[model samples]
Target: MNKNWSAFNIVSVVFGFTFLYLPIVLLIVYSFNASKLVTVWGGFSTHWYSEMLSNQGLMDAAWVTARVGLLSATVATVLGTLAALTLVRHTRFRGRTLFTGMVYAPLVMPEVITGLSLLLLFVSIGFERGFWTVSLAHITFSMCFVAVVVQSRLVSYDMSLEEAAQDLGCTPFEAFYKITLPVILPAVIAGWMLAFTLSLDDLVIASFTSGPGATTLPMKIFSQVRLGVTPEINAVCTVLIGFVATGVIIASLINKRRMVNNARTDADI
Candidate 1:
């Protein structure tokens, strides 16, 4: 409990953060530059933001990314939560080791490999590769991440509460719905947010899985960057950074509050 940050730790933390966020900080700062040339700072202005808003292609890509992220994250959250529950509650089941390895395999697999495999599977099945295909590819990888997050939370969870609810006449489904689910709700929400951000930020997998008219924001930005890094792209990237940062902050606050409430409830009991 007497943990304290050493000077070395402090310096390392500062250095690490600087290394990670320095580029992002510069990008955000330069997004407002009035110059057409990305390197030149004519003055501070919102010209690029306006241009970003007016670009039809960029808007379309943003819309597609948002929808894909929402759909994939939601479905992944559900499937992942169910998978976590199964792994935790039915540990002795046949092939449990194989199941566990498979669930976490995507977490370590290269994005290129996962994307290529999914693409091949879709082609083999003759599935049209478009918005749905990209979303499915995202879900395929995102669910594994979600499972890891939710499963960690489930591992330390006491199953007695659910058992007590069941003993009091609640069905197994009802017990989980009312008892176990609430305790793990914070982890579920965190998993969903993480999945959404991953989907939004994905370029390699999206590039592999996406078909015509299914371009995501990252893919659009990447394509544009290949041509040139424009102020418009910087503005778009700044906006995305803000969006993801806000989601992360909100998720952290919610988790912190939930933990505080849980602690208070436990102390009172």
Candidate 2:
């Protein structure tokens, strides 16, 4: 098997990454533009960043987004972890196939359809569409993603550890808390992060579900974008990219450290 990278391979790799990130790089660079116009750069400055901080609408949207993301992610993680356990630990239950299908259907379902359906359901229920409605909608879609992530991890898990814990007189809950939960914590965290990102980035679902005074950051950005791309939008996007990148890096480092510690403990045993 050939292991060396050809010139063509190197070019392809570079081109792919450039194509993916060049726009982001340009946006970040232009966020510092002194000019109000995005394309016409008038020297590097932090004017947009300053202006963004002072924009009350943007700040309120950011708060709403943060709240929705946190609430939805936390709830989705719990529900998803439970669903994964139900599918993995409990075998041959009635209606299992139906439940599994429902859990997975959202993954391939169109966002427009999901959003519209959710909106209709809420309207039928006479539920007021606002922050809670948006959060509920987010949880509905994000939970499936979390379930899929945790399910993948659960499939490869060793069941013997839990059985041994039970044999040592641990109750079912205790066994899960001490043995099974720790082993699958990484997947759970990954699911939470995925859910949070989805909730944070979703515009379509949020737009459909959200009501007056509950605008999300993405929705706010979309409204502004309709007028035209401004340096302010560029600054907001840059900040969002930075925040997400930092979170992913930190989570990765924590997971890596946990894995290393687990490996060391196993070696010592």
Candidate 3:
């Protein structure tokens, strides 16, 4: 029985790893391929990377996407933090459950529904679908992710600290800024990073909201891929993968360091 279980566990672990990482491995390998066809690897070369950099349209689209991601992430983080604070701290309110549901509804709702609704709203309102529209759509979805992250952090938080600050004569606003904010800032930052990544990766919502002139990198890549595989797209994907990996690593390190410092402080106390 033990032998069979051990073998099963080993197989499960191997399958899990393969399922999660095989696509990433393939993407990285194809990014280095010199051939235009993704499956056919002619040879390894940095030529595609150079070509990607030189493509003016792709570059512009990338810049636009970055700007939209940054702006939307910022907006989402702020709004989400506020929503989390309200939901966690203020317990007594009429329609509070409804409000909370509305705030988090996007997280569970289908992306297609969200995209279609936003597109229809934009059309009805006569809003020109472009960068701002895309940013707004991103904020709507990304804010829910931020809210969930911040709320989880807040759940583990001790409210007595804020009360202690207030008892010492600090105003509520000052107490939040000096005490509550410090404790939750790491989570807030993490939420912001999460929002940024989601916004950057979003395609369906952006496609629905974006106009012709404000094409994002993902939109451009999707258009190109319909025609055939291109080394340039692989190169772009490689860069995106690198950026996301670096961001995740940095965030993990920062969280680990904070945890270590917190443990030491607790020991001292």
Candidate 4:
């Protein structure tokens, strides 16, 4: 196949990326604007960044979002990994179709339906809507995302590696931990990051499940945005973007380094 870049391909790539990223670029630019008006540029300044320090509500919401994202992502990663393993490795279980359907249903379900269902479940169980409830809702939805991510990697995975470890007298659990887990660690990490991002950016489910004093960053941002867009909101979004980008870059670098080291070790052997 010819790999030469065609004129149409070049135009499409340029148009697609600009369409996707131009809004984010503008938002980041506006975050540093000295003007109170989001659209009008008085001058570039970091005043809003400084002002964010004194915003107690934003700080509190940030703390809650961070905690919820971390906890939900961790729990979701564990549950999703196990679910993926069960689906991939044990194909003969009873109700396998039902289980797979349940795992996938949430992915296509609307946010409003998921939120309402969770709210009703909590209410019926007499579980108060609050921080824990919000976390639980996040975990419930995010695990499916993790499962999807890990399951894709598992599909192309070499099962012979795990079987070899088991044949060497390793227990089932030991084989999985020693061989399967290491090979799929990249996918697991990717799933956790995706779950964390979803939890952090979620608003509808959090709104339904959260109570007093459990407001997340997305909830707080939505409340403020309903009133009007402001430079402060832009600033907050910029910070969130920066944090996520930094994390992704760091993870990529770490994974690349690990791969290089592993390659070197294999060459030595």
The numbered model that scores best in TM-score is 2
| Reference-based lDDT, residue 11, model 2 | 100
1-269, model 4: which lDDT tens digit per residue?
Answer: 35788888989999999999999999999999999999999998999998887999999999999999999999999999999998898899899999999999999999989999999999999998889999999999999999999999999999999899999999989999999998899999999999999999999999988989999999999999999999999999999999999999999999999999999999999
Worst 10 residues of 1 by lDDT: 1-10
Candidate 2: segments with Cα more than 4 A from true spot: 1-3
Tens digit per residue, CA lDDT, model 1, 138-216: 9988998899899999999999999999989999999999999988898999899989999999999999999999999
The RMSD (Cα, Å) of candidate 2 is 1.5
What would the TM-score be for candidate 1 when compared with the true structure? 0.94
TM-score, predicted candidate 4 vs. hidden true structure:
0.95
Residue-level lDDT tens digits of model 2 in 1-269: 35688888989999999999999999999999998778997998998899999999999999999999999999999999999998888778999999999999999999999999999999999999999999999999999999999999999999999999999999999999999998899999999999999999999999999999999999999999999989999999999999999999999999899889989999999
Alpha carbon lDDT of residue 81, candidate 4?
Answer: 95
lDDT of each: 0.93, 0.95, 0.92, 0.95
Estimate, for each residue in 57-124, the C-alpha lDDT of model 3 and write its tens digit: 99999999999999999999999999999889889899999989988899889888899999999999
After superposing candidate 1 on the true structure, give the runs of residues whose Cα lies further than 4 Å from its correct spot. 1-10, 267-269
RMSD of each: 2.1, 1.5, 2.0, 1.8
Cα-lDDT of candidate 4: 0.95
Q: How high is each candidate's TM-score?
A: 0.94, 0.97, 0.94, 0.95
Candidates sorted by lDDT, best first: 2, 4, 1, 3
Task: Give stretches of model 4 more than 4 Å off.
Answer: 1-3
lDDT of the structure predicted as candidate 1: 0.93
